[model samples]
Target: MPDIIRLLPDNVSNQIAAGEVVQRPSSVVKELLENAIDANAKQIQLMVKEAGRNLIQVVDNGMGMSATDARMSFERHATSKIANTEDIFHIKTKGFRGEALASIAAVSQVELRTKKEEEEVGTQIIIEGGQLISQEVIHIPTGSSFQIKNLFYNVPARRKFLKSNSVEFRHVLDEFHRVALAHEDIQFQLYNNGEELLRLRSGNLLQRISDIFGRKIKNLLIPISEELEWVKLSGFVGKPESAKKTRGEQFLFVNHRFFKSTYFNKAVQDAFEGLIPQRYLPSFFLYIEIDIERIDVNIHPSKTEIKFEDESSIYALLRTAIKKSLGVYHVAPSLDFEQNQDWVFSIPKKDSPIEEPKIKINPAYNPFKENSKPFTKAEKLNVTEFYSSFRNDDITSDLFDAPSANNEENFLRLMNGRWMIEHKGQLWCIDPYRIHQTILYNKYIKSIKNHALSQQLLFPLERPVYDLEKEKLISIQSKLFAQGFDMQIEDDLLTITAIPSDILQEKVLDIIEELLYQLTEHSEEEFSVFFSKSVSKVSAKKRNEFIQSSQIRPIWEEFKNLEMPYLNPLNKKNYEIISIPNFE
Candidate 1:
């Protein structure tokens, strides 16, 4: 029998690797920007066309590569960061695995031009489908420039899955922001299809934050700094009052590399407990510094997820650090001042007599008690016998089996906005109030249980996924896979033929997409867990808003009324039938 396995072609290998590194336009942006940052680039210019669907060019004033290095850079597993196993733990620089360039080149037509500062001549190299097409020595500035065109072109399956231009562009913008925020001292400029997006000059962290997120963030950030035995925490947390309903602003970094940590985020959230509203999530940009051996960065190919040797110790330290900062200053701003200005309470005038009050509420009764039953079988029999009275009348033949009259006088609105049939011989009424509540409750409960189905197109359905996301996708891929998802992966493109369990719902997809962006940009934290908590927070908030008192009428009181018949709908006119004649 022939061997079942054989070595794959170079292009296939590159495409598979690209699946690990370049999930979307944002993935390419992250890899290239990291390369620039690692090169110690002082100034970088980024230009994108069609939200990075068509072109992504990065020009950096950093140490350029030689003719030989430029050509070899497109090979898989190629790296200048590590040569031996021991060096993995004691790592400092970013972009270590060297799969980023090779993966990116696999999916796109790439062009590179560079010259070292000391070298008078530069080198130019071009590649398509992981195949080198040209290499030549040329004269250029003492920097490197890379232009990636027709991303995922070789993989039509991936290209076919791309999202709308606006959506893909937003992903590109997100990547640009993260890289720019991490290295605030580096000059970075972003342009979309020749239109200038952001030009960030070297500045302080706060300055960078303000430029990217807007000046509103300036007032919310409070400096946080603490040094423990080995680990150091330094950054800013948004004031509790400024917390947002959305999770777009939270960021956590480790030694300048962006990361997400649920444990650490909980520490931050715990510190803000009681300071912010229950449903609100506080924003922060925190970074921790620890010794290299203390944490492992080489766990994944992308090196975004790190495992700590002593997690509990780190958690305790982070909690204490955040709480200590909160103790020193008021984090929740005083909104009472504004409320006071806009709203003034006036004391009721003593001379004004109160209008006639509502009739005294009936005493409550328990359903378990034998006599407290709202309806008895006898009442239903009586109603049926009464119908016979109308059946004998030839002149009122239409009245015998006619639909129950919906008259307002005979019906009373239940606290839940439902109408009870109020029939007191010769009178009929309906209550619309109760009708609304019943409809709403049924709808809400059904929605929560997944009875409702909604479909949304996966934007950029054929988009590439980065290494950071490859693990995430793989982790959740099973859940999606079980739901009839047709997951096909090629160089840079991941096409989802089916969406799993309605993850494509507008709300669900938005959060998932945000989580993907967060995971890609910040590689240090456990975002999935953090996001699960966020999902809980958001779900709880939605439930509260959906079922709040304003959304429905009070039902508990009406549910327990004295002297009610089992078959008669509870209403004002049923007093005689239940022996509560003084109900008026």
Candidate 2:
């Protein structure tokens, strides 16, 4: 047998390398933006078309490259930032390996135009599929411009794996935010398909954050600053009021480079332990400055993961620093102000009659009574009968057969939105909230998938949305429409002419805002589920209130109607039965 192993050709090797360096259009965006920053550009404009499937251009006004350097940029392993192995440990620039350009050029059509400030003319280099097409003198400005076109054109499989335009554009926006956020002194502007999405002016970190997010973020942030022997940290963490159900707003950077560390994130989350809800995450943008030698950034091809020398110490310090900052300011904002207190001692009209409410006392009921039983067995049959109704459905609930419901008006309702039922000497606890949420979720999904039912409002409702959430809302407009949300965007106002029949118009804005937050962290599919869940949650609360005042007859009927009543949209148990011990 002949020796099968052979060295891969340059073009093949570069294409293979591109697989890791340029996984998606957003990956290309990250590389180009970092390169512009490494060039010491004061003003960088990122221009994209068709969500980066067609074009991705980065124009910068910085120190330009020479003609020789322009030609050498597309060569594999060719770099200007690194000299030897020792230099790798003490690196400062973003693009040092030089594989970015070479791998990027191998998979797409690239055009580079650059000229030094002192040079009278510029050089233009074009490469297609790793082949240099042209290198000629051209008249241009005193900076660099890189235009990447037809990303992954040669590789059909990669292109086939690309997500929707909305998703791709969203990812691009994420990269843009990460880069623009870490460097506050550099100006960055983003243009998506001819429309200017973001215009970030150079300023302090706080102002930069407000520019990227909305002006309202200023009120929600708590400033954090600390300096130690090995590490110095400074950033703003979101107040508890600013915490959201989604966890996408957190950002951590080192040496003006954005990276991700789960350990560090836990440090921040731990700091906000009692301030925010358990599932909710407070937004934070933390910057840490340390000696470059103490960390490693080359672990991943994207260069977003860093391996630190004393990670445990850094984690403890970060937690303590954030906790200290949180203590300095109040977590919950006080919205109440001084007002009239006349209502506290109101005097009714002289002729008006006031009736004292009557309270019924159970004469025989006593906590000390040994004969006090859990809920009666009749309520057991009510629940057993409810589950038995599902026996006709294909998915059997594996519950025991029970008799028909005898009056459910006497069932006991616990204070915490739970219903007590007795079955076979076992006390069965039922959660009406989870049941209603799940039923509404299934109904909404069915409506959205089949044909949605919408109610046209008498007048269009206008809701104020910030610039940060506008893109997300717009991206899923079609999906929202399918779910019966007919919306139009003009500036920051989102006008809704119709809403789903299941949703209350009064809570539409809140639900939409929650949906926007969900979209920030979840994909379109996941966001749709979250959207349904949120709407169901709102509807479920109202439903629970209605059931609270009325008898349990309606609840029994609703439970009996569901094909699968056990699945909860909130990932909680609908009901649980605990056995009661018999004591003589």
Candidate 3:
């Protein structure tokens, strides 16, 4: 018991370090990619199988290692990037602690093949669970190739904590994007399970961004460049219109190394305060280049967090730089008196007298008249006839069938964006939006479970989306078809030959966009739940606008018959009751 504080074994220490460096397959991807960059690789290829559960491979045409160096690279604290304690302050390379390879090898089966450019042959080494299995000279190219198989194999608990393939792959894609973006001149290729996910050729930053995200991002980006005494900031900020509900596209890099800093992100958000909607985050790819001594990047094992000596100054500068760029690009409104010549319209001279506006009115029009044309049919119909007509018309009659014809006194009345009704001698104030969301949620869920009715469009609608979004849509194409969306992909454009009968033609693009956003934001959610929420969100917005119309009564009818009329799909209370006795 007194000697319990003894030093841990090398393998145990390496495995503990692995917890920080190799959190998941994506973490391994980030470390290997950075190592390749540090080696001055011009071309890097990343290959993964089963979202990196089975295998992860990285081949880079970099300055390969020597036979002796290759064997020592997997040892704890073995590094060439730093020599002394003072070297950490001036560090520029990505991996310096030397724990990356050691930590990675501790948790998985790692294979390494490396050869110096001047060498004729390479050295191949295989290690399993931090134990060297074999090392031999082999005839390979003058570069380095690393294969990590059975990741977290020795740590069953860690392996069990991994997410689904789609989610894990998304994280891997995020890491790949960060590395490929920071170094635009380096060619990068990524393949998932033998299918090519991305192939980014050597190009400029803008081109790299466009290739990774979609070509549409090119137009959405607004260039930002500024140089100050403490920090030099440069990169792109997306337009306010391009802001998204998710934070997947936001990136911040310090000296070509990707990092996450909520403080810096807040600066960007503050600059776009009124430009974007609340709860929405704008996309940004900002790179801050400061003196290596001014920032500390070794604070975290992943190196994604940096501590700046002058964070306040950097924040102010970053905010001003982005704000200036937005104004310069005309993305933010300007109050300059100088008008755009293209938008100028000549006003008619006062000499040419202005014509008086004409107005038309029906003097006999009385909205409250009982026998009026609009009110005659509505007033004459009883509850039974009114609901029967909805059923005959194939509307949501089944959802709203009345319990009894004598209970017609429980009528629906629209007031201030809510539905006021009398039920069980109590006044109920219902949020029509939430109630409609519940109705559509169940309806769409049922439609998705069965085959939804598709309304063929007279003219097909073509919408242009990003390449990644196109892939996402393709992955869920069968589910979309089941939900009454007949979509066809041609190039980057998605054509809609048909849509759900209840969806408006004008809102198809908006609906699809929201659907894809929800899907991307919640990839781990069950498909049925995701689809229902997406449909409900889109349909809710439209229903909110529709609740003001004269046709709201039928919608309220359906709301009343819901199995859970008091709560929405999100579990939010939809209505509150005002007891008649309490009111009296």
> lDDT of each model, Cα atoms only?
0.67, 0.82, 0.84
In the predicted model 2, the residue pairs found to clash are none
The TM-score obtained by model 2 is 0.77
lDDT of 2 by residue, 48-128 (tens): 999999999999998899999999989999999998999989989997888999999999999999999999999999999
Model 3, residue pairs in steric clash? none
Range of the 10 consecutive residues with the lowest summed lDDT in candidate 3: 393-402
Against the hidden reference, what TM-scores do the models get? Answer: 0.61, 0.77, 0.81
Candidate 3 or 2, higher TM-score: 3
**Candidate 3 residue-wise lDDT, 228-319, digit = tens:** 77678999999998887655678899999999999999999999989998878998999999999999988988888899998999999988
lDDT tens readout by residue for model 1, 1-584: 97899899988988998887888888888888888888889999999998788899999999988877777788888887788888887888887887999999999999999989888899999999888899998999988999999999989999888776655766776677767778899999988778776778899998888777665567777888888789998888887766754465778778788766788778778878788876568878887889988988877765667788898887887766666666555444443422435457877799987777689765785666686567789999999888777745544333123343553223333454333333444322222333223333333334434533434455535543432344456555654443334566553346655443424333454444444544442344443344433233222222223232323223322422322232222122322233335566
Instruction: Give lDDT for model 1.
Output: 0.67
Most accurate candidate by lDDT = 3
Which model, 1 or 3, shows the larger TM-score?
Answer: 3
Per-residue lDDT of 418 in model 2: 74
